[model samples]
Target: MSMINYKYSFTILLAGFFLISCNGKKTENTRENNAENQITISEGQFKENGMELGKPVVKPFTEEVSCKGYITAPVNARAKVTSLISGKITSLQIRPGQFVSKGNVICAITSTEFIDIQKDYAENSAKFVKIKADYDRLKSLREENIGAEKDFISIKSDYNAASASLNAARAKLNSIGLNPANIENGKIYNVYTVTAPISGYVTSISAVLGQYADMTTEIAEIVNVNQTQLTLSVFENDVYRLKPGQIVRFNVAGSTENLLAKLISIGKSINTESKTIDCIANMETSLNKPLINEGYVQANIITAQTELQALPNSAFVKSEGAFFVYILKEKKSGNYIFEKKEVHITKSNDEYSAVSESLPEQETLIKGGSTL
Candidate 1:
């Protein structure tokens, strides 16, 4: 009876051990099924989560170089108004920011030298008339064989000398802004008018109403906004990529609007102090108002174009100094799994980025992977 009890107890223990082993196997299988690193979702769940898939595409990529610069008027567009003759500023007609047209009188000056020039012109004119009349009379006598050859020659020489003096005096009056015909009409005035050389806004005024102005003094400055240029300083490394007619996009400092410009010229040599070359560009569009000369600006020059394999910027996920994306894999009907992938990005813009590690073009990519 004891031996029978021992056999029954041994059987019970064996059965219990087998059951426990089966249970452990089931638990291990369950954990293996759920331990995948990939994420699996049904079609309905994907739509609910607002997930999307796309394929990599080939698109045109533009390479750009960044630069800093300022707005400046071209040399021909800027004028330094100066007096051609020394005089006292009797009347000042221009102030800073005033618009003036070409040939408009900017100031009036009075000087004793101006009066003396006019008087000399008038006296020379009278002397020339008398000498010419005497010359003509002597020539008539010589032709009729009634006057000596020596006398006629002497009179002709005097006439030529008088004519030269009169011409020189007239030119001097003209140089002082006096019309020679008006001066010859006996309109002698002490004040000489100084006119604007170009149509533009006056930027500076240095002549006072009662101050004396010399020929070398800068009376005022005029700048034509229409001829303004964008002067950019490009580093030596990127200067070789720039060329005339390239498109440029720039923004003024302290403004949000982007402006357009076209490259016009590039400097021949790099500056020794700044180690940069000058790039000149013209504005393609008119501003609402004239830009102040020497206003600071930031610019990007579109240098070259090529085709590249690009993806939307939303596809990138960055972590721990590495970038990643999600690629989709079909598991079964109505279900999909996404596997994380490592990629190297070459370049990026606001909307798209060019990546180096290329996948099959047919492979599906999960959009908005960074949010996962």
Candidate 2:
């Protein structure tokens, strides 16, 4: 009877151990499943994390690439007035906002360097005359067989060298805004005259009258407002949606009406500070409103329009250059399960993005969360 009691107790202990092991395995499996594709958050925590639920909606969406920038002149439209020779400004009659025509005299620089250039050209001209006389006489003698070949060859070389020196001096004087012919004719130029290279308004003058200027100094800037373009600052996230020749609609401050433009170029590099790509657009026609240089502009690069599954910009989260969203799979006893699912953004603007994936049946996405 004691042995039977012992066997029965042993069997009971073994069965109890097996049942406990099974229960532990089940708990482990549950945790593994939950961790694989789920997040559990209590209602209090959910609200604290600023979680919001949303359902994906199908709608007729007009996709656009939204951006903002300023109206400014392109590089080709801006004329940077600089001096080839350093000198003190003897005369700067121009003022800011004054209009200037191409080749109009803007300033005169009293450069002693101008005098030196003139002197060099004069000396080169005199030397060239003497060398040419010798070369001509030597050539005549060579043809007549009246001189040694070596002597004529030497004179010819000297003549060629002198000619090159004279031409160089002439070019140098010309570059310094002096005419070699005038200098040779005994015209003494003490001041180097500077002129406007392009027709535009004098936006600024960096020099005061009598201030010394150099090659490095920007004497003035002229801008032709007619050549102004829409300089759009497209964010990096939306840069991929843009291309050259795309149409852009722009609006200025205090105006609801849009100005039309066509995109002409997209930037190759991104702005590190603003994380934006610089884009340029030209107007389809003359703008009705006055073009303000460096004026602020809000723009939309019109891409396409179609019915799409859409979500707010906040609904998408980016990771490793890919986009993702969270969906509420189940709710039980105040615990919520949010399954992270990858998503594709076909097109986006400031507030909304069209997603390629539609929501699963009956599943609502975590449209936004502070934890994200």
Q: Per-residue lDDT for 1-372 in model 2, tens only?
A: 699999999999999999999999999999887687677788888877777887766666666888898989878889899888888988986898888898898899988887788888899999999999999998998889998999998999999999999999998987766667788898887778889989988888888887888888898999988888998998999988887888888888778776789999999999999999998899776765447678798888987767776777787888898888778878999988888778888867556778767657555554544374
Model 1 bad stretches (over 4 Å):
1-59, 242-246, 260-265, 268-270, 284-288, 309-343, 359-372
Each prediction's RMSD over C-alphas, in Å, is 7.1, 14.2
Best by TM-score: 1
Give the local distance difference test score of model 2.
Answer: 0.83
Q: Candidate 2, residue 305: CA error in Å?
A: 4.1
Mark the 10 consecutive residues where model 1 has the least summed lDDT. Answer: 362-371
- Report every candidate's CA lDDT: 0.86, 0.83
* Residue pairs in collision within model 1: none
